[model samples]
Target chain A: GESVGLHLPTLSVQEGDNSIINCAYSNSASDYFIWYKQESGKGPQFIIDIRSNMDKRQGQRVTVLLNKTVKHLSLQIAATQPGDSAVYFCAENRNNDMRFGAGTRLTVKP
Target chain B: GAGVSQTPSNKVTEKGKYVELRCDPISGHTALYWYRQSLGQGPEFLIYFQGTGAADDSGLPNDRFFAVRPEGSVSTLKIQRTERGDSAVYLCASSLNPGGHETQYFGPGTRLLVL
Candidate 1:
């Protein structure tokens, strides 16, 4: 079955440093990709998204890079803060059905 | 202005019991979605609704799981003969349109425990 997966399960970064999370997807037909952040006991919050046609999309302190040929996607957070500590997930949309990755826990140290 | 909202923030049920989870989508949004997230995992797509009808139900695990959106605003997910494996956080999201590229706003989610 086609799935989205993350390269690491946990990441720790110091405050004010940059953090990057990587994801690999197996479905080639997926056209849309999204990043979500889930805090403890809460649902996923939309971070950013990018389409297959675009290689990169930037948000406030957040950036999403997509590599269609490599079936890879990444989320970069600048000046990591303690509030940024949470589980991050990447999802791919195929035929309006979105498939999500297992998720990577990001821990920001003060 | 308001995002999606779910009812009964938490639910605990015994095996063989039936339960219903409710979701109130954002005002004027025409698309709704249901997902399940287990421990240490991302939300798994369960179903999607466009307006008053279900547009995609392929993610439903089995017949015991059912959902309905009668008024195109509030949707309900029903689980029958619940098992312990059914325990998870059920999330609801809504989007302005029914497409893969549209942004979907999510709710806090309903936590269910089958005991």
Candidate 2:
């Protein structure tokens, strides 16, 4: 079926280490992609976004990489901290409709 | 300015009952959307409101699920004859418009538990 999925369901990283979460999208028409972090009992908070025209976008401590040729997206968090522990989701947009992936649970162990 | 807000952070109802969840968008936001999040799953789009009208309701599960945005600022999601399967976290988000550049600010969400 057509959907977005992550390569890993959960990822654990040591404090101060770098963490990378991968996502695969099936829709070739997706023009934009965004990464969001959702703490327990809270809604998803926007992290960073990238468009198909660009291959990489960097935020404060996060970076989003898009490979339109492979239909893959990646989110990299540098110097992961305990406060960053949450479920991270990758969303893809085609036209104005957005679709989300199952999400990757990120746990930063201190 | 404050972000989006939702009423009744938690609600519990029995099966076959009716329930309504409300969402108040940020000031000036013209696009509102409703999504449902199941355990360990991503938020699934339920409906979208552009201004005061429903622009796309293709994500609605069935006739029992309905949503309306009367004045373009606040919206409500109504579930008729709710079933246990309807239990999930209902989330509301608002954006400047239904475009890619506008960030979608989300509310805390209303956790609905159907017994």
Q: Identify the leading candidate in terms of lDDT.
A: 1
Tens digits of lDDT, candidate 2, A20-81: 99999879998889898999999999999898899999999999999998999999999999
- For candidate 1, the per-residue lDDT at B93 reads 95
Q: Report the alpha-carbon TM-score of model 2 versus the true structure.
A: 0.95
lDDT of each: 0.92, 0.90
For the record, the alpha-carbon RMSD of candidate 1 to the native fold, in angstroms, is: 2.6
Q: Which residue runs does candidate 2 get wrong by more than 4 Å? A: A1-8
* lDDT per residue as tens, model 2, B1-115: 4998998899999999999999999999999999999888888999989899998899999999999998889999999999999999999999988776667888999999999
TM-score of chain B of 2: 0.97
TM-score for each prediction? 0.95, 0.95
